[model samples]
Target: MNWLILVIAGLFEVGFTTCLKLSDNFTNFKWSAGFFICISLSFYLLNKAIQTIPLGTAYAVWTGIGAVGTVLMGIFFYKEPSDFLRLLFIFLLIGSIIGLKIVSE
Candidate 1:
């Protein structure tokens, strides 16, 4: 259902952020188009999700997914640091997202 849709939207948020990174300040045409497409789908699905889910809860989950995903993408794809504290916080964020899902239910 709607929770699934919300999760998909959150994943699209991930996709858009990755695309944004690859866009290279709009210098890359394909990535730029991907960014726009992903973001649009993300928002559209978010809106659909919010028809049942509370706005604050949905937004929080959405951004949480985006933040965690972007950080992971940075580490895996861009050679960004994955120091102890950074990883710990990422795990914490993931736990919080899960908590929100439980509480929302």
Candidate 2:
């Protein structure tokens, strides 16, 4: 259950980050509101997850998910570069996150 919450929190991290980009330095009211709401929810869920999961492990995984999601969003939505090396490194990051999950047990 906690792990599920952690994953949800990580997803919210992605949501908040995307809103941050769309917020245009907090000038845009809707996106800025979304940013604040998502961030608050993300942190609240993260706090709940940490009640069961180790701090370091949970934090690392959360950030890893956010980082990967953000990069993918950048590529797909912003049309950022999708070069081979960048993709390879993203996969490597995924592998590392999985490794962390395995070892954390």
Candidate 3:
């Protein structure tokens, strides 16, 4: 469904962002390619989802998922900081995303 596509798009957003970092300013060819491909696909799917979902809701959810996933990826793979306040805000972002979905329905 559209929601599934939106979720996949959001996941692709995370992937593209991570690949962007790994690309090292586009110096790494493989990661850079991945970054471009994932971003294209993410946007394509997001555009598809917006046909049904409200623009504001879809955009917020998309960015929320991307932000949360990217932060988790940074924490786990890149060994970035994982402090309490950081986690609290991540959860709050999640809550806001969920709230958007609920109110949208």
Candidate 1 ranges beyond 4 A from true positions: none
**C-alpha positional error of residue 102 in candidate 3 after TM-score superposition, expressed in Å:** 1.2
Clashing pairs in 3: none
Candidate models: Cα lDDT each? 0.94, 0.95, 0.97
TM-score sort, best first: 3, 2, 1
Where model 3 places Cα greater than 4 Å from the true spot, the runs are: none
Error of 3 at 73 (Å): 0.5
Query: In model 2, where do residues sit more than 4 Å from their true spots?
Result: none
lDDT, candidate 3, equals 0.97
RMSD of each: 0.8, 0.7, 0.7
Q: How many residue pairs clash in all the candidates, one count each?
A: 0, 0, 0
Q: Could you give candidate 1's per-residue lDDT for residues 1-105 as a string of tens digits?
A: 988998999999999999988999989999999999999999999999999999999999999998999899999999999999999999999999999999995
Number of the predicted model whose lDDT against the real structure is largest: 3
**What does candidate 2's lDDT look like per residue over 30-67, in tens digits?**
99999999999999999999998999999999999999
Q: With candidate 1 superimposed using the best TM-score fit, by how many Å does residue 84's alpha carbon deviate from the native?
A: 0.8
What tens digits encode model 3's per-residue C-alpha lDDT throughout 1-105? 888899999999999999999999999999999999999999999999999999999999999999999999999999999999999999999999899988985
